[model samples]
Target: MLTAVGVPAVVLLAAGADAQRPVEKPAAAVVAEAPPCCMELVAPAPAAFSAGSAAGGRIEWVASSRASVREARALPAGVAPEQGLQVKTILVARAVSAIFPEIQSIGGVRPDALRWHPDGLAIDVMIPNPGTAEGIALGNQIVAFALKNADRFALQDCIWRGIYFTPGGARAGGYGHYDHVHITTKGGGYPTGGEVYYR
Candidate 1:
């Protein structure tokens, strides 16, 4: 009787040990179940700017002066040809010109030797008497238009009178942007540290 009881006890102990042992899973199966840590997902590019979707009104390209083009070409290296009064810049300038026909002067794609310019993504529209009530109102209207229709133009940011607006919101800080509204596009690529107007 004692031997039989001891045998049963040993069998139960063996069963418990087997239950505690971890089962080995196939390496391939384990890997198949886990997602890669560095997996990359591609996103589609944003819609291209079109006349039908342009803000303010229809876009019309304004010819750039030979001097302007020459100056842009002479800018420092790494600046692409498009960055200097090219297609993208012309598009933006034309759009604004259509919206504000009263705007006598518009500047686009001027290479800044001291600061970074968005290759083909930036334009400057001069505000008439920027310090006065009318000028501020016009600036506000333009800023509002840009912010409201940012997707239409692929605008990344706009700066006016020391204030800058991104899709996120508005902040204050910029140099020599008081008289003109400065607009930048995401398509031109981001600015380097030195290119940023606001610290």
Candidate 2:
């Protein structure tokens, strides 16, 4: 994991000024600031597994009850939220965007009162022509990535093609979510804060 740090300014004195007076110049240091809401670029996480199978790419549980460890507001730096996702969800969106260029939009924060959507902790990774073979393949890859990096993104659950994936493993049944991959973070519906990491 990468950490952000600040630089210090430097002071230089001119040689041979006056006997009592000297010229001093200060050089300011430049520091890169992370965007508001703990937004930072992250390298792709190391793969936990190579394939997506019941026995191949099972997600290991490494989740947090609270998504953010520090106080943050608004979305990540470049992530565009569909509805109104929480900070942690936006971080996941940003990670997906960085990893998968084919993905265009992500849906967040809905009116569903019974689930994580309305709380802004869930996201729908929209897929184009999801019924097609290519689309399914891409969704599977994404699901596999999510499962592998469950700890990095603080993921709680991932659902694709009506199949649910947790750190425990994958299970099938139910309906809907065929057009997009649904993912939820650790937080329940409530105000979220803190930093989010991609890897």
Candidate 3:
């Protein structure tokens, strides 16, 4: 885990410019902005497990509830609703789906055996061909979008193609992230004010 810090600006003063001149001070420090989303450029990792098994079984395709459908519609275009998804997860899923409709599915909530999946704060968008050029481009685009709008989306962390992003930085690690972009939220829902988990 990493914490967010403020970035300071330095001001260099000329030596002996004027005896009585006042020196200007910098404004309040700004929170350190995260580096560009795609910091590591490694080749997409090979899938280590079957997508179905990783997601815990065949994805359920039932119609979304009225509220869930409405939340999905609130997202950007090209988002296909997944049944039984929580509202917050649906919002996160739609954000990625809006960027890449080619995603085979967006998974929410793992089976009982997988404890890593948070009840409603996480989502996994499946990319069928991560090694292909198109797949790579789509992955990059999704990451870039997430980084650009991390605050708006209340993103706590994101992982894909063996790379993960935190408010502190993006680094390479994790297995089975090759076939999907996994996103986790900060507060289990939209954050109010400056509430961010990674920060």
What is the full ranking by lDDT, best candidate first?
Answer: 2, 3, 1
**Which 10 residues in a row give candidate 3 its minimum summed lDDT?**
65-74
The lDDT for every candidate, in the order shown, is 0.45, 0.54, 0.46
TM-scores of the models, in the order given: 0.49, 0.56, 0.50
lDDT of 3 by residue, 16-126 (tens): 212121122211111122122111112233213344432442222211211111000123322434344444455556655544556768777666454436456677777
Which candidate wins on lDDT?
A: 2
Task: Please identify model 1 stretches exceeding 4 Å from their true place.
Answer: 1-83, 86-88, 114-118, 174-176, 188-199
Query: Can you rank all candidates by TM-score, best first?
Result: 2, 3, 1
Candidate 1 per-residue lDDT over residues 1-199, each given as its tens digit:
3233232111101111111211223322211121111101121333233534233232222112211110001111121233354333444455455455557776655557723253656777788898886776666666665665465456778887777777677776644577878877655343332221100
Worst 10 residues of 2 by lDDT: 26-35
User: Which candidate wins on TM-score?
Assistant: 2
Report the alpha-carbon TM-score of model 1 versus the true structure. Answer: 0.49
> Cα RMSD (Å) between model 1 and the true structure?
27.9
Total clashing pairs for each candidate: 1, 1, 0
After TM-score superposition, the amount by which residue 117's alpha carbon in candidate 2 deviates from its true location, in angstroms, is 0.9
Which runs in model 3 stand beyond 4 Å of their true positions? 1-73, 76-86, 112-118, 187-199
